[model samples]
Target: MGNFTKWLGAGLGFTLGGPIGAIIGYAIGSVIDSGVSVQEYKSEQDDYKRKTKKRPKVKSSTSGDFEISLLVLASIVIKSDGNIDQRELDFVRSHFIELYGKERANRAFKLFNGVIKNEVSTRQVCIQIREHMSHSSRLQLIHFLFGIAKADEVVTASEEEVIRKIAGYLYINDRDYGSIKAMFYNEADAAYKILEIEKDASIDEIKKAYRRMAKKFHPDRLQDIGEEHLNAAKEKFQSIQNAYEKLKEERNF
Candidate 1:
């Protein structure tokens, strides 16, 4: 078997079933071709199903599950604007390489090429993810999607619409969605939005909002997910800090 097939077989968990599973199964079939036997893939699914049936409830997402879900969503967002830019594709590829070494990133891109061909049902995929992933992880997923959308330096209307739908389906409230979305834009109120506050709020309210946002976007909350995600969380946490600092300077507090 090929390295990508081996990694796919071992890494996936809850993503081995549901809409996400079906999408990934199709991608695997398309990409691996003769590298992986049908029985071997089915056996892995059966093993996962049996293990899940024995458990009390569905567990939080595994890193493998997160990786595949990210790829799937990235494909959806990349196609949303009707025209796929190479820079956006490069961003996804390089981001993966940075997060998971060159070898694993190459394997991921092979699977991603297959995924990009399929038309995904964004709502179903997001629902499946919402049911399994933690809130913090879901937040991180939104942050990453916005990064993908803005990779070309301009987020198209279509791309923003698709991502907004995804956030809603994933059960991310407006405040949280706006906060992550604002991180990619340079509007006058961007800092206030990132902190989830109004511009006319008192200095005390701004301080309170900063503390709340800082806690919500804290890197430690994602420590259990993985080091790669923890690093991403740090970027998000820093954004909150920068927003707070900006507001503080503006208010002279």
Candidate 2:
């Protein structure tokens, strides 16, 4: 609970207030004082931000808020088909443990339970996260959600539509969205899509794209966040490696 309060919805009071705060507040009520009001704190922040020209990148930060946002948005996809699959639960649990230790993960687990039961504005949530999370972090967030969707080995149309709309709201361009989608989706030119290069792209073009993508998803950028996030970034880094390797083998470049 102490760990979560550091960043959960750290700056979301501007637009959202009720259910989200309730879910988080519900999880850490013991740790957080009942008297402290998010609305009151947010009111001050709102007024201060209005007078400032350079606002802090609260949304772009990969702190407590970013992690919480990931799980909340994930809940939307998990409940999209009106059925909860064991595979999805297992996938989320494993990632949760991997990201946060057992103590914190267990405490935060309750938030997810509440999220699935309540109705959330997925579009608004996406907008909030997009405004705060870095470009690479946003890519990884969607990539993990897709993994959840396909955990049962079949991504339903509803799941696809929900994930697609989330990506759009995050301000992710079509090429970037297609690249992430290609990684999970079964497409003939998935390697090209993952590399964000065209099928007929020259070897030099492919090589350049691979390097660019690799730099963008590098794990070092997440080292300041936490070891758990660094591990996740490593996994994404490997994916980019595999995609490039596949192309290199196929093209003999």
Task: Give the per-residue lDDT of model 2 (tens digit) for 48-87.
Answer: 3342223333323545555677678788899999899989
Cα-lDDT of candidate 2? 0.70
Question: Which candidate number would show the highest TM-score if scored against the true structure?
Answer: 1
How do the predictions measure up, each by TM-score?
A: 0.90, 0.78
**Candidate 2 residue 121 C-alpha distance from true site, Å:** 0.3
Candidate 2: list runs displaced more than 4 Å: 1-19, 26-62
Which 10 residues in a row give candidate 1 its minimum summed lDDT?
A: 48-57
Estimate the TM-score for candidate 1.
0.90
